[model samples]
Target: MLSEMKDHQSLMAALSENVLIVRMLLSVIFLPGASAGCGAITPVLFSTTPNFMEGLSGSCLQIPCSFNSTDPRYDITRPIYGVWLKATTAFNVTPSSVIFNSSKSVNIYQLEMIGNLTEKNCTTLFSDLNTSYTDRYFFRIESGPVRATACADPLQITVKDSPWSPSINISGGDLKEHQSVTITCSALTPCPHSPPELTWNLQQDSHRQTEKNTDGTFTTKIQENITLSDTHDGYIRCSARYPVNGGNKTAETAVTLSVSYAPRNTSASISPSGLVSAGSWVELNCSSRAKPPASFTWFWNSKHGTINVSVGQVYSFNVTEGGEFYCLATNDLGHQTSSVIRVSIKDNQVSGFTVHIILKILGIIMLYSTIILLECWFRFFKKPKMKTQEPTYVNSEMAKES
Candidate 1:
């Protein structure tokens, strides 16, 4: 009888202990706000990027957001609806408090929940946003028994009357002649569905694309490939046009391009152009078009070949012999030679009239000498015998007549 009583007591104690353990497990699994192992429940948290957002009054704005809850009962795979409340953190579903609701066909505000709520993506878009929409906003999620508001991580918004200016970027070192570079014009695209139109002053064919940034924003970009030249040294402008409800808003930005290139159109000119007398001084000037000012070197084409003369923009020298002269323009980029020019030189001691007078005097002297020689030959050599015979008959007749 004693053994039987001891075994029954031991079985009753064991059954009581197992019943207590079963009760604890049932409370953990069925009780509201109770976690497994009877641990503390985890609070829902929200994560968002760029807590502050600035937008154009006539344009649109995008809010990138995500949320999570550590409670195992929260099932995201169920039908999830996202809500955006303006100026209030209270979990209210009223029309005045809620600006957007993914479950509703239309909301009080022109807002859309573009993100996949089931995937915990709560990114929202607000179109035709004005200054009245500038306020703090909160996000809320509802799925089955999970209903929570991410009020701790509110998004602040500010709207302005003017639009944001576009930016220009040049890649591939410094701008230089004959070198290809990529010029990118980027404009902020808060609403990816209606990206801003981008236009630039560069005439090259460009490639256009819209990309998402790490900050959860979108940007519309146009890239152009250009081979630089001296003519590219000017201001390049890029403009962004946003299509709003009333009209299009525009903003522009400009960047100056300074291109480095070799000298071009190099030429040398003489100050006193025409004929130059020997032993007279004349000035030669060299000029060229270059990004950095070019250094000038005068060169003379002699019988032996091209020889370097003086080094300067202007060179003055006494004219002794006629020859071809040119100039060489050089810079860090490259060099160029000017066309050859001829410099004429004449004797300074003798004038043109003096040589003409000397030649005329010599011709007159030769003619007079020839006339004297002819008379002398006639008087001294041929007439001595012939004159005697002719004169005898003539003299006799003349004496009789007398």
Candidate 2:
């Protein structure tokens, strides 16, 4: 009986301990709020097609985004909508999605497909994107329980650098005689999808003029009817200035005009065509052909150097003097001159030279008069006297003539 009683007591103690353990396990399992679980955060992403492509006026651009929910329990029957914000605006965010969905908060953000966002894919687009939206756009995504976001690298739509040498097209053909002409500058490089501004300037004049932007790359002509002057060699240039990813960028090109009417070819020659004797007058008439008559100057190789004969272009030098000489002719266009002439005065001054020339002239005149008088006398008298007198008279007349 004692053994039986001891066994029963031990068994009762074991049963009581097992019951306590079971109760503790039940309390742990049924602890309040234990069933709720925290979900992990997952990231959403965005991308642009062509990543980069040229843009035209009134054109469209597309942006795509992919998203997934962290909590399996969260319903994604509809993906969260996304927003497009301008990077440059001071607004906390860009004017509400330049693109987004119209339906449920969880509905797919579709850019209207007409202008901006189109379908549930979170694929957004921009149409007629103007200068107002010239700034960069980024993506922002939001869902029922979770919000995630991703950004695309800034896109720089700008006019590319122009060709090394650019041709200028004038509204009318190249103008002449100080006439006015309209000239438009277009970029050889294609324009970016982004908006750009085109401008013109004359470097020499420091004149800045704006051209009408036809497209991002082309400009409407600016009429510059100038009463051009020599100084008008001023260079005309065009530039396209626009925004870039890192900052701002610019492209430029230029052209120069040879205003039509110019001075004509000119010449200068010596009358005797070579060295003029020393102390003798040397005439150098500098003559040039031009619409407006040109000016002339005489230069002498002097001790002081090539000295301009302040007098004029026709240089007169006494051949008795020694010097090197030349003549220069000029017009509004330019100037040119004759070859150098060397002059040396010889020591001997021949006084009889003039007398000799005078005597020779007088003798010739006397001889001619005598011949005429005799010819007339012979013609009238010799025929009557006889043909025999003719030979003698003819001989005398010939001698006088000689």
Candidate 3:
């Protein structure tokens, strides 16, 4: 054991170049009544308080830690310096991860250790925490030969991002029209004395309730039982307000309400409603506004038991004579047939054909006018030119001599 102590001292000396390790040795060397060989003292059995805790990002975190030893060789109430280290694993402890060494390096956190080593409390405060700070943390004591560390089962800490809205709990099912349902919204209050106020924006009759927990925290719950109707099938919101510096901070949550019902407001229409001809194109359309869009079925009225033409929103085909056409819209709840629309198929040349024939005659007249213009241009304005005779020079004088 004496040789082992010498080897430990040599290893400590070799690592003295690191400021953290040097500070750790100084913390141990400055302990009260630690004036003896380093190896003569016994190690301590250390354990932390509240083996696990949760922290929120973008906020300050406090870990209340305390430890004591089972070994009778040490006194539990004495002022023994400590070294706090953070590690990924508790089995293999290393010296490079030392966070702080009391009596030498202070102010490693936002505030100095709020714990008293003489009282066996090693609580620490970390400020402006972020997601990357999730890990296991433990403490170590290095006074004389009593150099000890606790990492086998260090404290587990998980960090979460700040929540945007309050938690909303709803209890109901199978929401039909005119149904009643209960909804509750809750928000956490860090202060017990001042509970937050809750309100629902849907203008429903709601009640507010608050509870005080044993951990000095408060919870505000707002509940409402409302008869849901067509007007209630929109965004329903709940908000919680808490007092701040001079005003208030509020958080809200919203949910869309969907109500199921049968098909309603059914109607049918023909594309060409006024006039039609035999073997002319026409379309019949059926529509309804329903929760789960209703199915459509088209029918053409005839003496032979109303022939079922098709099953869809639109039916298009050529019609022979004037007939009756309608459609049926059905859903899970109920079904309804639209009012019959009488289609008039003109067998004796409808007035629409006269307009079409007039348009055709106008087109033929324009074509003939264009042909006449071209022929007149060729006969008069576009006539071929005749060849000109060459002029005779001094022919008059030659004629007089002959």
Candidate 4:
């Protein structure tokens, strides 16, 4: 009887063990929350773009998000709902913590779940966001028997009062005159549905486009192909205007262009402009507008055609003769010739005065000599007759007195 009782106890113990094992297997198969020993529940995983994002105070923001679960109980075929919680990881839905809920017809904020919930896309758009909306947010997925929160990763958003400045880029070598280049201005587009308006100060045939970045962000760009000139050597500005709640926010960036070109407006001038005296010092100046200070070559249009006279910005020499003079300005890019200037050279004033004095003295001596010769001829011819006339006048006066 004792052996039989021991056998019955052993059978009872074995049956108890079998029951526990069956219970564990059933739990693993039916219950999604079942732990190890039979099966382990897989955690829900989340994939999101740009862990951090920036938003304008009165504008909107779009978050690119997707999620998946390795557990078989998390069915994607069933109807799914998404929830966004601010500053809290607890899955418990509350009026204060729940900023967005797909099931609710009306929520706390202006939000929309644009992504398809059945496809596991949790992308959401939050509109009329201000500084208050800047916080860490958590995503939750609820589908049938599965309810999971992506607590391992969260998105941190920063909202600012002003919009971000646009960026400017230039391609195809340094800016040079007559060289073709592409200039692009790009602005960040956090929400593709409401992209910022991009504009630039340059007036050219431009192309505008909105493109998606690899990091899931969108950018609106305006580009133009330009052939550089000296006139383009100034500041170029690009501005981005975003539509906000009350008004519009604007931000701008500027870049100064230093375009290298040859020489322009080349000209030559002479100092003491009127008539250049012979044997006197005269200066010929060459001037031009150039990127790199241009080198000058002075030329003289003599009887031998154009001849190189000197090489420098300023040329000084003793004026020997008069002729048409010009200058050539040259740089790495090209060369330009200035308009011809006529240089008039005259005899020195001092020498000319000396010659005039000598001529006057000669004229005076010749006149004096001619007067002496005439007086001598008059004396030789009429002296006797003059004495006789005086005597007759004296006799006539005496006779009248008598």
Instruction: For candidate 2, write residues 109-135 as lDDT tens digits.
Output: 223422223233444455443444444
Question: Per-residue lDDT of 1-402 in model 3, one digit per residue for the tens?
Answer: 999999999898777658777776776676432332222233345655556665555554556667786556565555577776677654445756676787766445443466787777776666655677777777777655566766433767666564336677767888766678876788764432345677877555566677754432346788777776656666768776655434555678887778776777899998887878788999989999777789999988986769999989999988876678899999887788899998887855557788899999999999999999999988997787899999978789888999
C-alpha positional error of residue 55 in candidate 2 after TM-score superposition, expressed in Å: 9.9
Model 4 Cα lDDT, one tens digit per residue, 1-402: 999999999999999999999987786676543331113343464646578999887788888888776657887788888988887433343657777789984478788998888877778888888888888787877789877766656678888898999999989878899999988999998878788888888974466788988877789999988899999888999999988887889999999888999999999889979887788888999999999879999999898788899999999988888899999999999999999988786655557888999999999999999999999999998777534354434588878999
Candidate 2's C-alpha runs over 4 A off are 1-82, 85-98, 101-125, 131-138, 142-146, 150-236, 239-364, 376-402
Predicted candidate 1 versus true structure: per-residue lDDT over 124-203, tens digit per residue: 88888888888877777777887776655677888878888999999988788999998899998876777888888887
Q: For model 1, name the residue pairs that clash.
A: none
Order of the predicted models by lDDT, top scorer first: 4, 1, 3, 2
Task: Please report, as a residue range, the 10-residue window in candidate 2 with the lowest summed lDDT.
Answer: 33-42
TM-score of each: 0.70, 0.31, 0.45, 0.73
**lDDT for model 1:** 0.81
Give the CA lDDT, 0 to 100, for residue 281 in model 1.
Answer: 95
lDDT of each: 0.81, 0.49, 0.70, 0.83
**Strongest candidate by TM-score:** 4
Worst 10 residues of 4 by lDDT: 33-42
